[model samples]
Target: MTGAVVAGAVVGGTAVLGGCAASPTAPPSATARADVTRVTVRLDDADALDDVVAATWALGVEALREGEDDDGTVVSPSSLLTALAMLGEGAGDGHAPFDAALGAVGDERTDAVNALLAALARYEGDPALVAADKLPVVPMLHTAQQIVVDDDATPQRAFLDRLAAGYGAGVVVDDLATRSDALDEFARTHTGGLVPTSPITPDPNLVAVLQDAVVLAAAWKTPFDVALSGDQPFTVVGERVLVPTMEGEFDTAAVSADGWQAVRLPYRDDLVADLYLPPEGSAAADDPSAAEPTTLAGLSTALDDAAADRVLVRLPTIDLESTTDLMTLLAGLGIVGADLTGVVEGSAVQAVQQAVLQVDEEGTRAAAVTSVGVTESLRMPPPNQVVLDRPFLMVVRDTTTGWPVFLAEVLDPRAG
Candidate 1:
């Protein structure tokens, strides 16, 4: 299913409860910076970070499936394989250890997803025999590591060298003095392009005590065009302002209530990038009079029978750039058990684990970009359209495992 369609459905239902506005584009304020920094530092603890990431991914998948009839059943086996491949690629030589750690997490996630899929199949009125057929499920995980050193003979270097030997790989060293004439470039390139290396240190004494993990990044096959997209009038707080619109055809599911609507948008390539848009007067702020809180359950009900078939979908071409620091994001998901503190599993002891992930626009400008440009021109022809001029929730999911990859709020089109 297309992201726009899926997101349209989620948004249509949520619209009944409240409305959303785009987030403004500005540098992080003092408090925001502190919050981000704290989250980043806390995520450096490996064990805690892993648990948090897992929990967050699970929640995202479950939330996306809550209103769908699929019952959480895994759909495409190839999709699952692709996700596993990405995990493996990220792990590099650490695939074995990473797999071992993932195995330790058990099959609870797999079982849960399959059970949901089975329920969904039944709901679709499939035969009992068909529903009982065993579905193939394969889950994979991996880890990748990079070590920084000032000299090959140092204790820190020796520890990393030993670790690399175990993984059957050799370490590569670079000179920082001539590189950009600064320590920043050297650290950025050598440490997997992650900034603020303050969170990671090469302590010889702690080498054996540390745990390493992998990170994955993915996007949709079809991208939004920026050139064709133009500023259009959008309503916010009873006032109208021009917002950029990238129109395109997308597979979507939507619902409507009294005077509100919700929509779901799914990307073509990755399960992540699911968006939910709500209608006017349905904002879910602290007070109902302030805004309405849209629930997954409400969306499912609204998409019933006739309502599902009647939703008019003329989706705007939207260009969005989203970056997520996996570690910090997981911490925000309420997985306190895996924070900097250790987690106790029965009699087993597990310390916090470290995994870093960062995504940037990286040369994707608004104009002259082929992918975004094509999608933008799609709206010129006459067709039924739905303007997304309000706030919405965007979710990234793994189709194979039905796991949520990430979630963010598109508060402002300009900022996105």
Candidate 2:
């Protein structure tokens, strides 16, 4: 299979963008290696730090908006952003759309991605040791990136170098049409088997495929009492249904603002889940179509400005998994007809993402796999008697940089 045929299958009849087109950059030197293994890429952590965080936060919000009608949904902005950052680096002059989406310009995007990856890298470890059914005393956040290429193809050295530098991504040479099992194993290994299959299919017509995966297993600082958990009626799109719920009391940060109440629950390693519950009878709570909730910044500020105090909390045990066609969302961001001559000649990209998350009385376990064939793609709390019996938003993020890893809209705990 060829790159165009593989990309074409992913994109269908979507029109490629017109402009400078793919620049005729020089190919790798004869001696340049194609079997690039994963290496630690050292990057300055201070570069474009804030811009990257905000950009990824915006990406999470967009995903929530796109899935408003679904009973529940989850998206990993960090996973999606990582994959996009790799693809964006290969866009050459066609980086405009990516820059706009990432909130960085020119070489700034590179710095932003590197800095973001560096920040997250501090927590990467063994996902196998993470316990999903209990609060993990040692939380685990694992990330892996790879460039799967046709055995006969040699990706550009500059492109590979950028990926290594910014993402620590490795190169894997395989027969795209027949080695799909390898891709599946990669996904299962990286995600701790939460996501058992790869999002991108192995196609003979493909040159190189970019992949990013993230797994987070964390325990809440204060575990809810298991005996307090029970089945109860929860409202979903104005309808009521029975779901397993957990009740607890703990000292946490919370605030009420703009017809919404927000709470922050701490996890190990400065990670937190921020939950936002719309005011009762509000448009958002009553109608799923009115998906608007407070912004990420607003929720963050409200939680920050509030004092920690003992409050009662009631939340449902959750298990959710989703596979998203990210091109549907990227089209809204104007990421069409991307110029990827930097990766392969005459290449346009398409992407997909698979994600799974579970929340129990002990803690949370979540994993996301984002694959770009050229494609690509919380919390909270309350003490003070906050019963989340209706629709709400949850964001799980690293407190050190405020970069969201998982964002979910829980309209019904029974739906995944």
Candidate 3:
């Protein structure tokens, strides 16, 4: 389903929440600097940060779970987090809802993001894109942020400064009124063409638009043998169906508690998929989001309480795609007061996003592109196997820093 956009053109406004009142003009492209400064961190405070990140990710998974359909879910927690962090910067440091959504207590909201983003950006590697003729390829995680404003409007200088400094959002002054194609081109090129057309379109009352793009492609440490993969029974709730399963004996970490079995499946260098499988026949919870905190914490707690064991695991191969309206979803999560029209003569405001993910014997390729329109308005808004033969919760996380980048509740890999 699509998000809600401001129908009529946004006319006059000079509110801090909206764009500036300057005439339209395009600015220089915002390029990322090679050197990024790291925040001073301590080991004692690490657990708190992890808890906040876990809770924040749980909200993102909840938003997806509450979506229209039950098709196997796929989303980037990091993507949503980066987008929200940008918005939080737009609202300044004291915005309660924005800060709360990001799991920050006070002025630390943006800092939390800085720490996480820098953390992810620091431990970089090539993507595991197996070359047809060459050996393999490891690509860096591509993450970019930009504020595309109509040539007629201008963004708050302070907001832009914080956004650029804290969130790394570059300012892109564009003539969206006459050439919306340029906006589309930005989305396409930045996301490595994962998103062919920009989700943003032309709108007269358009002002400034916020954006974030993220892409991750990785290979598995021990590639699953295609010969070992074959048709296996997969249960969609109580109903069973046949699907391709990646079978192998992997030496990995596992956690078992409260009758739920959680296993980590390692991907090539630094990523892993944490699978939470309940004891056989245990009914799946209605609200999977409700379980994220406990489950995610359990995964971390398991790291200390449980030991790594060489477990025989069989996981299903999955390819899933989804489009979610984050504006509405974030609103539902209690982040109030999003003023996309602080200063501009134009229409309504909205946020729209498209994403795709595929997993098999190789590794994984996932891309997400989100567009914030200049015109009016806002609209709104995974897996496992033990034998993973049954429906289970899955988290696509970065092993280096233990960040749950993507989360899914997979019932039928065949559904979507």
Candidate 4:
């Protein structure tokens, strides 16, 4: 709710990421009013901007590397973005590595992120924004923010205030030195119960922790007909795995290019899920490089290479859960090796990412929790009758913000 305060005329068809919307409004909190100036900007078009999405997939690849197995993978770039934005806000804008990791340089980076978060804010607490009407099934939605500072530490009030206003983060000074359970409780409540177990621990040397989470349980804009879902065989590396598969013909975004096929399945809200499959031995499925088929950058070509069309889709219903410790991955990616001593001295941070994704005939119920110890951090298409029976990739993101909330590669749906 804190991020939705942009000022400007409402854009029709699309919800305005500015000043107002048809949803009920609340005056900025007493702590928020002073920083209200932060929200008056306009984001004419955030979906076209791939910075967040790109950076997110970059992190998702990091996750892909962490779980080297095939239980299906998921990552929340929005949560990581919010946490890094907090770190970046405190780390200052000139930190080149931090800037690069965020896929934004100078104010442009933060501004782009702000635009996206603000759009999310507009839908908070509004049923129309969170809940999809009876399209087949309704998804429950969850989005929250909170910051917990060790009781022994004192942080700059200005740093706290900026994040609170810009990101709608909640500030809590807690005794991490002793009672870490409270932090766990906070995480569960903030995520609307998507994350019941805490991924954080007390660090006596730790100064502060900033976090944000996204929990979505909404039907696909085009739900699979439940009656049609049944056991189907999915091809994996060594053998084929039989799993329950959902089927339907959806009018959505899809593309077929030189070596691959992709599609976008939309959520009822501003977010969507995308799937990509590469031709055998193709660069995408075989050798994923900068042009890795699963990367957000690669998906951007969906418009040009793959067009929106009606396609019959038959996908396995999967219930996947994963936990990724990203410190090693980030260090490998060179995004977390930056020296951030100026903000928090000798800071040792580890990012632990937890995610859950369940897809059936009804909808997807997914949630992600990014806890920085200092740790950190889909699609479509076809009317062409694309059956995801082989190994493929998946990603979920905001249609407007292009924020990649979940990304994964399903080598086998039965792994869970």
RMSD of 2: 7.4
Model 4: residues with Cα > 4 Å off, grouped in runs: 1-40, 45-50, 92-94, 126-142, 283-296, 300-308, 333-337, 375-383
Q: Give the candidate order by descending lDDT.
A: 2, 4, 3, 1
Clashes of each: 74, 19, 45, 28
Best by TM-score: 2
Q: How close is candidate 1 to the true structure, as a TM-score?
A: 0.38
lDDT of each: 0.27, 0.65, 0.56, 0.57
Model 4, range 1-416, lDDT digits (tens) per residue? 22111010000000000011111222222212224245533577543246765776676566665654556566665666666666666554336766777677645666677677666554344222222323223334445555566555555676667666665566555555444554565555544455665666654455566666565556666767788888888877646778778888877777766667777887665556777777767554532322352444466446334556788888887777777776776565454545444344433356777777667776665556676664211245542867888777777665665566566667678866
Deviating ranges (above 4 Å) for candidate 2? 1-45, 130-135, 286-294, 346-349, 375-383
Highest lDDT: give the candidate number.
Answer: 2
TM-score of each: 0.38, 0.84, 0.79, 0.80
User: Model 3 off-target regions past 4 Å?
Assistant: 1-48, 92-94, 105-107, 123-139, 279-290, 300-305, 339-349, 372-385
**Which window of ten consecutive residues has the lowest lDDT sum in model 3?**
4-13
Go through the candidates in order and give the C-alpha RMSD of each one to the true structure: 18.2, 7.4, 8.7, 8.9
Number of backbone clashes in candidate 3: 45
lDDT of 3: 0.56
